[model samples]
Target: MRMHKVNTAVTLGAVALLTAAMGTASAAPPAGRTPHPQPAHPVIVDCVWHPQVRPADFMIACGDGNSSLSSLRWSHWDQGSATASGVNVVNDCKPYCAAGRFHSYPVTVRLDHPQPWKKNPRVQHYTQMSLVYTDGRPDGFDRVVTYSLWN
Candidate 1:
């Protein structure tokens, strides 16, 4: 009788342990329902800037369903003179393919100096701009476009 009781107790303990483990597993959130704790990869499809306006504004529209924008940088060049800087502005957009969910971020870009043309007028100046999203990953969204500016 003593041996039988000991065996029964051991079996009951094992069953309880198994049951607890299963319950914990079942309580976990379902796939695609959990939030990503880190910034996801950024997908940049296109980036452009307009240099014709005073206090020029550069706009970048990009998306990374899994990541959030932390900062942005812009760079440009004209005739061999190159300039690069960061801007502080509002970055907001929806996920590339997902609807109803949108993310907004704040970024900063500081221009080294006003366009040389702005200070010493020039004719039809040409410039190229590129934007870089900091804290960007390579996965999550299909595409991301970021708009920025330097005033």
Candidate 2:
């Protein structure tokens, strides 16, 4: 009876050892495939000093509220840059400030040149924005216009 008990104990110990060994072997990553570290995503600093990611609407004229972007459809948003297609809304101000006609134009937007935010040191924000007019642009504007965003 004692011999039988000793054999049973040995068998259980060997089984447990093999089970642990197998588990450890399978836990390692596959050969020739190293995990890649993901890049940090940058944000857009708004006029009100708010950090936003892929915002649908953004204001361009923070001082007088004369220009802005709307209905933005972002195609790419990554660590280095972002791209979108939207409409540029501007006040013509044909005669005066209060009696100005608003105009809308199709535009493609690009955001890049990431830098550390002034308000938040740890977070990065896109500092430059480029707008390419596809259909039409506002007066005194070129085919492509670049603006420095507020940080």
| C-alpha local distance difference test of each model | 0.39, 0.91
Give me the runs in candidate 1 sitting further than 4 Å from their true place. 1-56, 60-79, 87-122, 137-151
TM-score of 1: 0.24
Which candidate wins on TM-score?
2
lDDT of candidate 1 over 90-145, digit per residue (tens): 32324534443444433333232223333224323323333343444233422333
* Reference-based lDDT, residue 17, model 2: 100
Query: What RMSD does each model have against the real structure?
Result: 19.6, 11.2
| Candidate 2 global Cα RMSD | 11.2
Residue 124 of model 1: what lDDT?
A: 30
> Candidate 2 residues 71-149, lDDT tens each?
9999999878999999999999889857998999999999999988888767789999999999988999999999999
